[model samples]
Target: MTPGALLDLTDATPDPARMRHERHARLVASMREDGVDALLLLGQANAGYATGVRVPACEQARALHRRPVALVTADGADPHLWTWYPDGAPAGLRADHVHPGLRLEFDADARALVSAVHDVCPTGAVAVDEWTMPLRAAFDHPVGDAGPTIGRAKLQKTADELACMRRAQRINEAAVADVKAMLAPGVRGTDLTARLLERAFALGATGNTVDPIWQVMPSSIASGPHTLTGDVIFPLCTTTEPFARGDVIWVDNGLQFAGYQSDFGHTWIVGGAPDATKRAQCARYRAVVDAVVDAMRPGVTARDLTRVARAVEDGRRTPWLAHFYLGHGAGTESAEAPLVGTDLGDAFDETVVLLPGMVLVLEPVIWDDGHSGFRAEDVVAVTETGAERLSSLDFSDYESTR
Candidate 1:
């Protein structure tokens, strides 16, 4: 496998077994480095990443009681999982290593978890992604945060992981094409969502990560929803509100496959044509993304990217939402580490250094104020040489307007 390869979409499929094994190896290495004896991942994506386990998509409240729990030790054995879906576990793990689901929020289940954990590792620093009150009170071990260990391990993508992302994005884009074709003055936000989700499922999407966002942006911030930060409230919850001609709709969403999530974002003008003013805004948005990407490579900091993005923005409203970020890493989860141009300030961005294998979703926005705006997302993988585009969707709407 090529290390630090530029991520691209291909017809080649990855072996799920190999991907799980490699990913586990990386987690083990990070665990060893961090002196973590065991990892108890309660988060859905974290558990799925630790083991090749899949659960049907559900709301957070339902998932809490029913979530799969993964236990990995520094001993480098297959994951020991307490999962509701035993069939979802990989074949590499023995049946004994897979146990019935644990109701971790209750004291009874926490006791069982404590016993099971002690039975295996008995001693070492334990890392946990989440904790309940009962869990903390019952299993009194040296519990540390799993963020650092998980972060380091997930920071770099294995070749197989990149391949999964490419396939997922391909499905997302193809499905989105259908939505774009059907966009019109009479279409509601839900109409776009229904079309995209249906097409995605047909295209082999395993699940939907986020409720599809088809926000019809207002002509001005004052005309839109009230925001304490005064930043444009993008991705406002979808409603039955129908689209009107010239309405600028910004879409952002995630589709899942093999536990990896694909992020798709782009702005569309209702009725398929944009005025010259809106078209100019789209061009400016592209320039900012280009400048940031041109400056992207191994060793660059998020500060460097933000600086370039802002420079190209030429003193606009930050080229991104003040509440959100210019870009973020993508993996098993929709958004993860190394965030850029966030409210976290320059000091934080300085700490986020670009490295090979890191996948980024850069979303630069261009607002014309009284007349709506333009925005879209582009996925790129930082390689040994430079940033490679993982997303292939082009600025078709912008081009048509031009």
Candidate 2:
């Protein structure tokens, strides 16, 4: 498998200080465009994006309860980080904006956070990525949803972000491939899940790094009847149920690296090659995916992709196959803005136009009731000319010799 063209590691790894400054600048520009005077960031992804400090996953639970917030103004000034414990702040944090030693409850902390925002920008409307009752009562000015603006800011990938995502995707594909090789009639679903995690870690996957860290998401492994029907139910095969011959094993998983993610799925038929019916179904699914991939390019809107996907399904005489989303933007979170297809309705801001530096995952699925299902997902990075597939694993063959 050939790796896609990527920036060299030396070039891709930006100095942490400089990276944070760049991110802050971009976010401030977005705020100005959106008419936001200041931002109160609550989401972990947004906080990390604004500060370049990796917020530990363990802290997220506390954040949800206590609300760890970051305040940034529209002038690109250094953001102020507010949390319950400033003494335990992440490394290299500037003490100027770090507000530690605060109460965990909403009223006190919300007052402190609002006061901090006022310290920076006293008179304009304050937007927040997430809001609570306490925040609404404490702030005097208007509070708007900052999720869309922050999400759009994250849509375009920096060179470092793209490189890290590419590496994570390669490692993820390798680990999934290892688990697929163990797909035998007697292998338990839990066993495969365990092996996937083991392989991912054994290959240097991590959740801590300023450059290219990674963390594996919980895997969805299903086989036999589970793979034969609607919605591809997850955790069904995560039981001790053993695989049976002719059972279709479907695995959907992802790995997060340097705050970016690699999300996709692949299906393997146990024991031998699929029969004619299964082969035909797989072919049709492949055709649909290929069509979408071929159409991915700069200036194409999500709505346009939706239309293309619908036309393909219609032409195939299997319109029912268009059940789920065609694809979505892949980044810090596995699923982000500019969601492709799946009836977005009239949300103009949500239907994003494809741009260079946007990474997307094209996933299409085909299923037959009481029979089997097929799905193959690939990651592609949009470029000045077109898109380049970052995932190099060979998904062409679904048959396993186990």
Candidate 3:
């Protein structure tokens, strides 16, 4: 049995200072174009992208009050970060630019934040990603939504950003190795999450973005959780339900390294090898991913990817979850722009033109109803010629000897 290797994987490294510098430059350039004098980033991913702060794994509510914030100016100076994670701050960030976490729940804190923004821009416009009532009430000047400008800046990744993603995938795949080694008929779904997280943190994963999904799918959609669309349910919460012989487990997980996220998904058969029909599903899924990856190049539209994937499906329901998407961008956020085949529809897809340096995570599901199915994510970095595979898991590449 063989495992897929990280494409050009690197060993351990220090903070990615150059990546942070380049990202800050992009943010500044975007802010200047948008006429945004200052950026007040409260969203976790946005803040991380602006400042390169590696926030720890925490529940969302807990992360909110304690989350790091970044304030970027059009001057192209270092982005100021207010955070509880002083160590996670990028090495090149100015010492004066770092500060303690702001507790915006307090009125004074909200006013202080407004003051901070005013300090930088004074009369110029400030852009904000999120806002609290307190923050909104305290503002003395007009502001724009930071999402548009920030999204534009982050659409294309830099060389160092690709390196960080590669490092992240390497760590995530290593953890999956341990989890796969322990799979057996008696193992429970939550049990797999335990091993995955344990191994990930041990291998240097900085955070777990979402609870691992180890849903044991049924033979058909009816036998699974009831859905409005009768489509096969995926990603049901992980539970202690122990596995039996030939249980089909759909594993999906996300974790972080230096603020960049890693996405992983694969179908694992318990106790026995995949039957012939199951292998067919795997083959179809692979074909869809291959077609999409082959078509990944600069100027390609997201519609082209969905079209190729649908051609492989041959009129079957879209190869991805109806509720989710065929592919999404992976970077500071687990899922971002350029999503393919989502509810946004064909018009939206046409507008999303692929650019070099955009990372795409394509997860195609091949569910052969009565026989069960296969789903897995393939992460690729769009390049000038085509795309580079970032993830290491291939459903055909057995992770362990059974």
Tens-digit lDDT string for candidate 3 (136-215): 88986678899999999999999888877887888888888778888999899788888888877877788889989988
Clashing pairs in 3: none
lDDT of 2 by residue, 1-402 (tens): 322223234333435555567667778888999999888887767877886645444445565775456788888767887665443355566777776634434688778778878878888868888766776788776788998779778888777777778767766777776777777888877787677777766764554222111111112224323444434443232557677776676566776666667774766776778777667767777777677778778897776766666677774433223444677778777778667765555255245788988988877766664555566677888888778887754655633322
TM-score of each: 0.96, 0.81, 0.95
Superposed on all Cα atoms, the candidates' RMSDs to the truth, in angstroms, are 3.9, 5.6, 2.4
Which ranges in model 1 have alpha carbons more than 4 Å from their true place?
Answer: 1-12
- A best-first ranking of the candidates according to their lDDT comes to 1, 3, 2
List, in order, the clash count of every candidate structure.
Answer: 0, 2, 0
Model 2 regions lying over 4 Å from their true place: 1-18, 58-63, 66-68, 83-93, 101-104, 208-237, 317-323, 346-351, 399-402
Where does the lowest 10-residue lDDT sum fall in candidate 1? 1-10
Candidate 2 structure lDDT: 0.67
Global CA lDDT computed for model 1 = 0.86
Task: State the lDDT at 224 in candidate 3.
Answer: 80
